[model samples]
Target: MNPRRKKRLLFASVLIGGVAAIASLLLFALNSNLDLFFTPTEVVQGREETGLMPEVGQRIRVGGMVVEGSVDRDPNSLKIAFDIADSGPAITVLYDGMLPDLFREGQGIVAQGTLIEPHVLEASEVLAKHDENYMPPEIAEAMGESHNKMEYSKGSY
Candidate 1:
């Protein structure tokens, strides 16, 4: 092959490889920035697997049972505080927004926000389990019970 043609081919190959590398890097960065929510059980068991606890101001989701009698709202500020519990520890969440219709004390909830403190989550979004069978799969698995076997209504609040 001619020297000039060989040089041109090598340059093209390098360029293509560089583009592919850049594309892969961009994809990886995007994925890493997209935060995920986890139940308390999941956070306790799989923090290493799921990168890290979101830094302050970084968005995240947390799921757990709403602590009974822990839901309180500030009438003027519209800020709400509730406690979320797993088998191990409970996380206190402060949210400033309208909660979902299903959100209530003693219900399963997934709150999305940033961790302002180690055990305090400042939630911007709150999703409550809709019904007895409405638990997220991850929460159900973490709780070690199949959704089919658990009757939400049977539990006496």
Candidate 2:
């Protein structure tokens, strides 16, 4: 207890345990590379004010609207599948490749990947909407109030 104050309390407890092991390994590598961004009615009715669903296989990022006819392609190739919606319930997704040319259906997209259930989603990157008053502020805050009446009739309020 007195060898130079036990070597300054063992170098201040090894520099506070190496800054608490690098802040818990940088919060477990940012929570294992978090994606999380659900919508399709918060992935089948969950996150309306923290009901917080998403957890089949995790890695989310859905967004919405694309459910018009629920595009389902697969002419023996670039796979597909659809259904996205936000006004409530609809998820599906799937995907395999080549889809952004302003996609289709009711428009508005996002995708990303993994969730595999609780309403599907397997996409590995879909992203559409590259024009017509761009909307992706987390799908206009999860399409609330129908994106404020389509940004007040496109005057973009």
Instruction: Write one digit per residue (lDDT tens) for candidate 2, span 32-88.
Output: 998988788777877768788887988888888786677989899999888888777
What do the candidate models score in CA lDDT, each in turn? 0.75, 0.82
Q: Once superposed on the true structure, which residue ranges of model 2 sit more than 4 Å away at CA? A: 13-15, 26-30, 40-59, 63-68, 81-83, 88-94, 97-122, 125-157
TM-score of each: 0.75, 0.39
lDDT tens per residue, model 1, 11-67: 999999999999999999998677687666545444656555555565678887887
Candidate 2: give its CA RMSD in angstroms. 13.0
Candidate 2 lDDT score relative to the true structure: 0.82
Alpha-carbon runs more than 4 Å astray in model 1? 1-3, 10-14, 41-58, 145-157
Winning candidate number (TM-score):
1
